[model samples]
Target: MTSLVVVGSGIAGLTTALRAASLGAEVTVVAKAALEDTATAWAQGGIAAVTFPDDSVEDHVRDTLAASAGLGDAAAAGIVAAGGAEVIAELISHGVVFDTDSSGRFVRGLEAAHSYPRVIHAGGDATGLEIQRALSAAARAHDGIVVREHEMAADVVLDGGRARGIRLLRGGVLHADAVVLATGGAGALFAHTTNPSVATGDGLAMALRAGAAVADLEFVQFHPTVLHAPGAFLVSEAVRGEGALLVDETGHRFVLDVHPDGELAPRDVVARAIADAMAEGRQVFLDATSLRGGTAENAAFLASRFPTIDRAVRAAGIDWSAQRVPVTPAAHYLMGGVVTDLDGRTSIPGLFAAGETARTGLHGANRLASNSLLEGAVFGSRVGAAATSAPRSRGRVGPDAAGPGPLPRQAPPRADLPFSRRALQRLLWDHAGLRRDAIGLTRAAATVASWRASRPAQVADAAAAEDDNLLLVAEHLLAAAHARRGSVGAHVRSDDPFTSGKTAPLPEATLIGAPC
Candidate 1:
């Protein structure tokens, strides 16, 4: 029987374990915290898929490519887009109950850059929580899968140039025929992120150390609407789909001046617009007060459709139904990581990755809103089945095999300031955050390198290990951002001379409201 080690227990990790177990493989899932603590659970926008009759796979693929800024792999986009229906059905089989209207039709929503209303949610804005609950329950019920919680995966155990298992931070090793990394993204690398505390780029750092090739580390997606209050609560784009608008302190809809889609523009465009506004000493706000004509019916509708967000907003002492909520852009997702093929095979044999940990090229430069959940479902199953049948020996097959050459290695310089996770986050936020230029990236790279030089050889605890991983990933991210001189997708080089005249005018259109 095949033995597999699945790291991280979000939708991707759990889905992988369940699929592998059904295929007669014994699986062990390792999680940094409790099984429920994951970026997936924090997701509010629901998964993207072609469910309605008006939506087609071709249209979905086209929207994905357009949002990617022509850098996305068409084949990859087609694969995920075509697989959406099947995966959505599979999620239903796993007991995920999506929201439906009074007539029992799925409640579909429209997000920025999507041509159709295909995003489906459950529990209103608690979509991720529902998915996580159902999948976690399913995994717990499976006899062939073992759950190991409160355990951090420190490294990938490699042997003979192939992945053998995982090294746990608390101690001991779990050996397996194949190892799958579904450990989420590096959102914690930034000071303000919607990801939970455990998203420290541990999987990416482990892959890098294991000699795997990673790509597109420069394209980090910053969400345009995180509540500017404490905790950085994410205000889902679905709210905008429901007719909310973004406005400056002077009551101007500034995003409309940047793009004709206004609040419905691509995430990177809206995020950078918000950043530019803040840079000019203007605060941004999401004005949902006029949603549904701002009547009592509107308040009830908002509370019903976005319970999670409503509660969070009310807890912050703001009635979003009546007032504009202060918002800012924050690191939301990473579109790059250990590069993998459609089957989830990384450069290293016996090493596979899925979900946010793998750069499957489905999301090119910028990720279409709500595609993250679909990627987890579609590719997580693929990785599970692939890992179950992976051969003991195989040639390099990832980015290193077919793409550009490997990234240049840089030696760490002498230490300067004392290293702290907060300081690292702030540095990345300032230099590598929403908008970056050559000088800021160069300075950020040197500072990160200096901190890497002072890292302890032995990680004392989980926190220390996270700090080390953050530093390593930060260095790589800075390097990638510095190397890419042009602005594209989520990676904006403010000083790029070639960026002028790149953007054409978008056709004006009315903001889309949620499907009735």
Candidate 2:
């Protein structure tokens, strides 16, 4: 029987494991933390799909391409859009319940860049948690799957350009026929991020070290309205889709001046607008008070439909029904990762990547709102089947032709290092955050290079491994951002002139850490 090792416990990882197990492969899920501790569990918006009669796969694909700003792969986007409904149906069959109207039809809602109300949720704003719960339960119940929690994948064990297993930081190797990387994104690289603390780009760094090609590492989507409070909670774009507005301190809709679509413009546009407003010393707010409409019924509906946001807002001492909530863009998603084909095959053999860790070109320069979840499901499902059925043959050489074999590691210093993860976080935020320039990128790259040089030749623990991964990932991101030199999509360069076009000229994918 073929054995597969899947890293991560997010929606993508879980789905891939379950699918692979169902196909008669013995699958083991190794996660750095418990299944619940993932960026997917923190997601507020629901999954996007063509569930309604009014919605068409063509429309979904078109909107995705438009949001991508000419950087999206049309073929990949179409696959995701067309296969979304089937994946949604599969989730439902696995006991995942979605929100429904009084008449018992699946309740669909709209989000930015979506032409139709096709985003389906469960427990209102608690959609991600719901999906996680369902997948986790299904995986746990399956007999073919084994769950390994609290274990970090220290490195990818490769043999002559082919992936064979993973090296665990705690010690031990799990040899497998295939390895699926679903380790989520590196949003936490930024100081202000909606991602959980665990999202430190470990998977991407592992792939890079093992000689896989990563593309578009610079196009990180910053959510336009993360609540600017103590906890920095995320304010879902569904709020705006439900008729809320983005207003400045003077109660003027500033997004209109930026784009005709206003609050519904692509996330990059809105985030840049919000950042511009904040840079000018103006505070941005999400005003949902009009949704109350002076009616108790409407107010109750608003509270019930977004119970999570309502509770968070109320706890923050601001009632959305009575006032506006302060918000700012926060690092949310990575649009590029380990370069992969539609089947999740990366540049290396015996290795595949799915979910946020893989760049399948579904999301180009900017991701359409709520498409993250769908991409995970669609590609996760595809890669599982493909990974299991493929023959075990010699794979193509990665950029580094040297085989990925176990190498001697140097242990991190026992004493406290001058640079800490918190300091790294602040460095990335200041230099590689929402707005970046040549000067900041250069300094950031130099600083990270120095840190990398200081890193212990060996990783002994999760902290040390993560620190090393952060430095490597930061270097790649900074390099990519520096190479782009133009403001397009999520990568906004204040130093460059803005193009007055609907899309950026097709961007060449910025590759890092690969041999010339």
Candidate 3:
């Protein structure tokens, strides 16, 4: 029997392990923390899929491409869109109970950049939690899979130019015929992020160190509505879909001036708008006060429709129904990583990646809202099957065929800066966050390079290892952002004069929401 090592225990990792196990492969899942402590569990927005009769795979693919700024691979988007419903059904089989209305139809919600109300949730805003619970339970029940928690994957063990296994930071190695990387995104690279603490770009760093080609590291997606309070709690895009509005302190709906879609514009547009407002000394707020006509019924509806968000908002001493909630944009997802084909084969043989860790080109420049969950489920299954079936001696596949060739890495100028994880986060947030320009990116590159020069020769523990990985990934991200001179998708170069015009309008069908 083939042995597989799947790193990270989020939806992607767990799904890969379960699928590979079912295919008669002995699988072991390595998680940096407990299974529940993943970014998947923190996801409030539901999965996107074509479940309703009004929705079609073609429409879904079109919306995905549009959001990607025409840089996404249409074939990859079509594949994921076509596979969405089936993967959603598989989630149901794994015990993920999605929310339904009184008539037992799925309670579909709309989000920005989606042409239909196709996002399905469970436990209101607790969709990710429910899916994580179900997948964790399913993986535990399967005898063919083994779970190893607190085993941070520090590096990919490569032999003869192929992936052989993983090196655990805590000690020891887990050898396998195929190694699948599903280790979430690099949100923690920024100071404010919705990702769990373990999202230090571990998988990407491991791949880079192993000499794998990565792409699109510049297109980091900043979620537009993280609660500006202490914990950076994410306010789901569904709230806006349900008629919430984003407003400035002066009670102006500024996003409408930026784009006709108003709050429903692509995430990068909305996030940059919010960042611009914040830059101008104006605070932004998500005004759900008019949602559902702001009646007593509205409060109950919000509580019922978004129980998790309601609780968090109330805990922050804010009654969202009565007042606007303070909000800011924060790093939420990475659209690019170790480049992989549709089957999850990276440039290196025996090294596969899925979910947020892999740049599958399904999400071009910007990911359509709520597509992250679907991408994880669909591609995780594909990677699992491919890992089990692909020949061990297959040759390297090179960079992703759908996207442009990998950005050239330029050597950085010499600079000196103090280095700590906190300092690194602040550096990225200030220089590489939301809106960036050439000067800021160059400065960031220099700082990252200086830190890399001074990094410890050996990682002594998990924290140190994570810091090292963050530095390495930050270096690459800065380089990519610096190289890409034009503004596109989530990567906004403020100094790029070519894209300084008014925001482009989205399709008419996707702009079908209003604030009450």
Instruction: Using lDDT, give the best candidate's number.
Output: 1
The candidate, 1 or 2, that scores higher on lDDT is: 1
lDDT of 1 by residue, 241-347 (tens): 99899999899999999899999999999999999999999989999998776468778989999999999999999988888999999999999999999989999
Clashes of 3: 0
**What C-alpha lDDT, on a 0 to 100 scale, does residue 8 get in candidate 3?**
90
Q: What lDDT score is found at residue 496 in candidate 3?
A: 87
* Global lDDT of model 1: 0.87
CA lDDT of each candidate?
0.87, 0.85, 0.86
Error of 2 at 404 (Å): 4.5
lDDT of candidate 3?
0.86
Question: Candidate 2, overall lDDT?
Answer: 0.85
CA-only RMSD, every prediction: 7.7, 4.5, 7.7
Q: Weakest 10 consecutive residues, lDDT, candidate 2?
A: 500-509
Which pairs clash in the backbone of model 3? none
What tens digits encode model 2's per-residue C-alpha lDDT throughout 1-516? 778889999988988998899999989999999977899998887999998887899999999999998889999999999998898899998888999989989888889988888999999899999889899999999999999999898888776667877878877777777889999999878878999989999899889888788888989999999989977799999989899999999999999998999999999999989988999999999999888568566568778899999899889998788788999898999998999999999998889999999999988889999999999999999889988875553443233432253222223223233578878888888888888887887777667766776777767778888888888888788878887767778888888858421322222332234521
Q: In candidate 3, which residue ranges exceed 4 Å CA deviation?
A: 293-295, 392-416, 500-516
